[model samples]
Target: MNIFVAGMMMETNSFSAIPCTRDSFVNAMYYRPEHTGPDPEPAAYEQFGYRTFLRLARERGYGAYASLHAFAEPAAPCRQEDYESLRDEILDDLRAAMPVDMVFLMLHGAQMAQGYDDCEGDIIEKVREITGPDIFIGVELDLHGNVTTRMAEASNALVACLLYPHTDFDERGEQLFAIGERFARGEIRTRNHLQRVPMLGLYYTTLPHMMAVNDAVLAAERQDGIHSVSLMHGFAWADHPDVGAAVIVVAESGQGGVPDLARDIGRQFFAARDETRSLRRPVDDILGAIAASPEAGPFVIADVADNAGGGAGADSTFILTRLIERGIKDAALAMIWDPIAVDFAWQAGIGNRLNLRLGGKTGPFAGLPVDGEATVVALADAIEQEDPAGGLMFGIGRAALLRIGGILVAVNSIRQQVYDPVCLTGLGVDLSALRIVVVKSTQHFYERFSTLATGIFYCETPGSLTLDFDAGRYSRLRRPIWPIDADAAPA
Candidate 1:
């Protein structure tokens, strides 16, 4: 059977000031038909999904045709013209390759474009129109996805990663393929039930600890006729009409019992929603914790607010500024995405000290400009390493390393979630040797560093995707959601 596989994946933070252009998407790793080649080491999170699809398709003996996979660094609402141009191109290709039995989409469900509140829904609806409702369509989403009503109505089956650190991309792909095969054989007709929970919170600390959500996921997985279940914590930074936690259940009975299961699970999620509201710590508290910790191992403090994975500018200087202020020596930051600064550093050879104004270039959310003279300790054409969080198969792109003050920052030309030690170790900054290691990421980094770290702290700072949901000026999000209103009831 021929399977058409393609979709755009990027978590657009409506609050971010940066505009996601075609070039931004390309720089983050856009692979077209002919461009698919050897996978890069220290893989970007989304690339893991694309590669998993390719491997499974080949293994299942299905003819796979992929249009293009374009992901941008998380940012503000997508431009209508850019979204249309990209969506139309992919749709045009899918239409030309019609008569395919199934379509597998890889999408970041929280995307908000200028004219579209539900970009995934828009794409699926357009695909449904072309495929005439008979074709089996399957979708795989990030755990942080905002599963909307439109999304539930447009696809045949959908599954999201269960893990917060999202170490389940390949497993989710395998499950999607298994479900697609069942759909193709008419063995199981699945329907989805989606219910929104009244909470806007971060899922960084929820996993490996929260029993309610994990038990729900486990119970749903064990139930008969329940093909798959997902709890999308929803990217809280994304300011859209539908921005809150959601529970999605895919059941085998086409008889429409999915919503019952969905509500049951969603209610359980809602009961525990209040507990998941706040971040692990504010910036000051994080500094205090670091100062109090006596362990020699690197204290990994994640600057969750400015995470690039959640559409925040990775250039935020809040954590870096605090580290510099407290005279925290032997500290390292995996990355700060300032291409211009990186370019300037590249021009200045190793061992040369140069005055640089780094980070805070994106917007006020990224914090103020950090001005300091940094010595170029080491320069490399490219550094390759395996992903720390990715089990056995993921990879990241070429990276460069530079030293600014006591902080050794590994800047990549590519935008990626810093999930592995290689993101720093490849750049000559040994994570084991440092007292503190600050990374610009959300939960994805936890899987890799949990074992090595003496302690892990998620710091609340300012950026597009901040934990301070109440502080954000949201124009379209439906009101009466959690923390936003303590007494708000679930829909």
Candidate 2:
């Protein structure tokens, strides 16, 4: 049996000013099938379950038809033409690969295009329209997705990554394929329901409360009829009516308590969010922790508000300026979005000194520019960083290592969060030698970074993707949600 496979990964941030354009899609990746087109153009990312699915297809003795795979980082609503064009590309591929037993997709559930509120839903719905419901459809999504009504209606199985660092995409990919196989054979009919928890908060799986919730999900899966239970922590940056936490329970058709269990877990998750709130600290407090530390190892500070992954400008100078003000020298802040500075450094070459204006170029919330006479320490055309998505390598284009006083900063032509130590190490900045390391990210940087740093700090500042889940920050949240409105109803 032949199974069709396609992927389009783009997470939209309704609050962002930048629009995700056609070039953005191409810059990330635009991989067409080898059979249809001349050599496909490669991008920095999109290695999601590529190897696993190949292994699975061989193991199951099934032929898998390849389609286009593309990924753009989180930004504002995608351009209408770009979304439609890419959607058409996948649809066209599916049409050509007819008589397929099943379909598998890799998608960012929160993808929103202009005039279309639910891009993932529209893709699935269109695929279903073409396949006529008989072809089993299975989807694997990032945990940070808006599990909408349309998506649940279109697909047979929708499973999200259980971990926040999203290190489990390969595992989840296998799970999706397994479900899709069972669905194709008509062995068991699935019953799925999405119960929206009326709240928006950052809850990482590493935390105790979320850990317990994940544990419960694991326990629930151990039951006879339940297939999967995933708490889709809706993307907070996306300003939509469906922008809140939700629990989706996919179970057998005859399962009795699936709906009840989903609702119960949703309520429990909302209640447990308060415990997750204490994880972040003020910049000053984090600095205090650094000063009070007895260990010499690098203290990793995660600049959460300015996380590029959540659609924030990656060039925030709030923490960088603070560290400079405190006269902290043995530090390295990485992947600051400054293309002009990088080009200047490239011209000057390594070990050469040049005056440069860095960061704060995106917006006001990005803070003021850090101006200094910086010495060029290192320069690389592209520094590759291993993504948590199964060790997939992503390049930080035209990277330059600038030493402004005691701090060695990692400036990138590509606007991206630091996923691995290679973001620094590739630029010749040693992790063990540095006293402080600031990564423009929230939770995604924890997996590889945790082993090297003495401790990790999630630093909150005034910028895009703020932790404060109030209605003032998000004006268009359709329903009353927690912290925003006290009386919002859950489930």
| Predicted structure 2: lDDT | 0.83
Q: Model 1: per-residue lDDT, tens digit, 1-491?
A: 77777768878777677788777666655767652222222233245446666666666777666777776667777788888888887798788777788888989888878888788999998999999877899999987888888888889888987777666777887898788888878788887778888778865434443566777787777778888888888877776667888887888766455677777777777776645445467777877877787878688888777777777668888888887787778888877887777777788877888898888887888889889988877665555544432353223443456676677877665555677777787667778889889888877787778889998887777566665665358777777787777677765
- TM-scores, all models, native as reference: 0.89, 0.95
How many residue pairs clash per model?
7, 0
Off by over 4 Å in 1: 34-48, 51-54, 205-211, 253-257, 274-279, 384-405, 411-415
Q: What local distance difference test score does each model get?
A: 0.75, 0.83
Per residue, candidate 2 scores C-alpha lDDT tens digits across 1-491 of: 77777888888988886669878878877676565221122321235445555557666777777677788888899889989999999999888878788888888899999999899999999999989978888888888898899999899888999998888888878877887778888887875688889877788888888899888888888888888888899888887788878998888887898888998888778878777567778889999988998999699999988888888889989999998898988999987988999999999999999988998988887899999899999988867887786676678899899998899998999888879888889888888998899998888899889998898988888878777865666667867787677787776
Please give the RMSD to the true structure for each candidate, in Å.
3.8, 2.5
**True lDDT of residue 414, candidate 1:** 56
